[model samples]
Target: MHAIIQSLCTLWRPSWQGMVMGELKYRRGGGSGGPYKVAASGRRIVRVSASSEAGERMDLLLFPAAGFAGGARAGEAGAPWHRFSADEVRRYSASLGDHNEIHQSERPIVSGFQIAEAMGALEGDRDFRIRFHYPIRSDEMVSLRKEGKAIYGVTDVLCFIWEAL
Candidate 1:
């Protein structure tokens, strides 16, 4: 297993009740084929592996519940993690002229794009994808943490995952 995959497993170990596996493979057009389903036994977990034959690889994980039961990762306990506030998210949205209710709501949900812009800058502009498991509400303070190349925002449960594409 690659170190990044290993690190990701460790990050998900606490809340996601499933396994993580990746088989690095390539496609016909000279690209790494991946993310294809590898067959799953239950909804608690779904397998994603590289397809030997394919077009685009679609790697993913489906857990029993949102963020595997909807809560903060146990690894975030103690010593205070970085936080993102509703004010910060809202302010960012205003600056971007994105007045969409999702980011403009009184108890707004943070803009996934803002989180991507702020947290994934290291990965470069428009170079990453963010998967939001649960909404990151602006009214509540949530902890933000970076693990490997992935950025996570969580309040009581895992909210979003910002990572390299």
Candidate 2:
């Protein structure tokens, strides 16, 4: 099971260079139970658990509910803000062949991929595990905050988190 989990982690590791744009540094703690850590460009860190079951159980512990409060604020130091329009969302959705009605509505719903794209372009060099807390509408503003290896997206609320690979 440990080997299976390790293999899965290796396979799932992000290969998108544009998605994470920086040199990767690897560090292995000296113990069988130690988590593997990979840091990227001083902004992102990927933690691989020593075992599969432990890894699964660690998700909630890694990101707690209180972490989403206050979200990312615009104009903060080191936090960059971005905006997307309904037309941009539609075009992006069409480009990806995603024809979801929610994305085409009058108050078009912004796809998560769109948010990932913007985050990837601006942040670069990280694998992201984003949790969508709210649906972003067109013309809404989104701000990104990099707290260590975690990147939070604040779009009127805590919208998503991009965990670096």
Candidate 3:
């Protein structure tokens, strides 16, 4: 089975409203390609997971920055991946109404992306969903042990939907 990878939650805040965006990257053995662009809406559900500490809920691992590092592995396609920093995680948590101490306290936090579904529907009447398969993340360092024909390939095109009233 192939593994699913997700990128960090990037936010663009120019004014009162904040926009959230993420990237998906991946590569198989013996390939020379590039990262592809992905479009997402409120209905999309991305599977995500990360390392957890004591008293932490396993569900928290479902966040975008919850899985393996996203980027180009050796002998694979695309560029390297950059892990998300605690500061970035904190910022996302604040913007998303997540005040977890694990993300707020002065401690080392894990970074990366995982697969997960959108927790809620879109806030407005506009709804959309996007699915992309490939190198699920972008970074400088990647695990060579996990790159193989059967281990690295698109397994499914996850579909997410949302309805606003």
Please name the candidate that would achieve the greatest TM-score relative to the true structure: 2
Q: Write the per-residue lDDT of candidate 1 for residues 1-165, one digit (tens) a residue.
A: 121222222222333332222112212223443333343233456443333243433234434433333444536722234455778877876665553555665676565445544554444433344565665565655576778877666776776666665
Angstrom error at residue 158, model 3: 24
Could you tell me the TM-score of candidate 1?
0.44
Flag the better candidate by lDDT, 1 or 3. Answer: 1
The estimated TM-scores of all candidates read 0.44, 0.51, 0.25
Residue 96 in model 2: shift from native, Å?
A: 1.4
Tell me the tens digit of each residue's lDDT in model 3 across 1-165.
Answer: 011122123321122121112332222223221232223233233333221122111111122332223433224323222344556556545654433344454542322122222211112212122222222222213221223222221212111111121
Pairs that collide in candidate 1 are 35-58, 35-59, 71-156, 71-157, 72-156, 72-157, 86-138
**Pairing residues by index, what is the TM-score of model 3?**
0.25
Scored against the true structure, residue 126 in model 3 reaches a CA lDDT of: 24
Better model by lDDT, 2 or 3? 2
Clashing pairs in 2: 20-124, 20-125, 20-126, 21-124, 21-125, 127-165
Error of 2 at 17 (Å): 31
By lDDT, the candidates rank as 2, 1, 3
Model 2, 81-165: lDDT tens digits are: 7778888888876765554566777888676556655665676634445565655678877777788887766665766667655
* Candidates ranked by TM-score: 2, 1, 3
lDDT of each: 0.47, 0.48, 0.27
lDDT score for candidate 3 against the true structure: 0.27
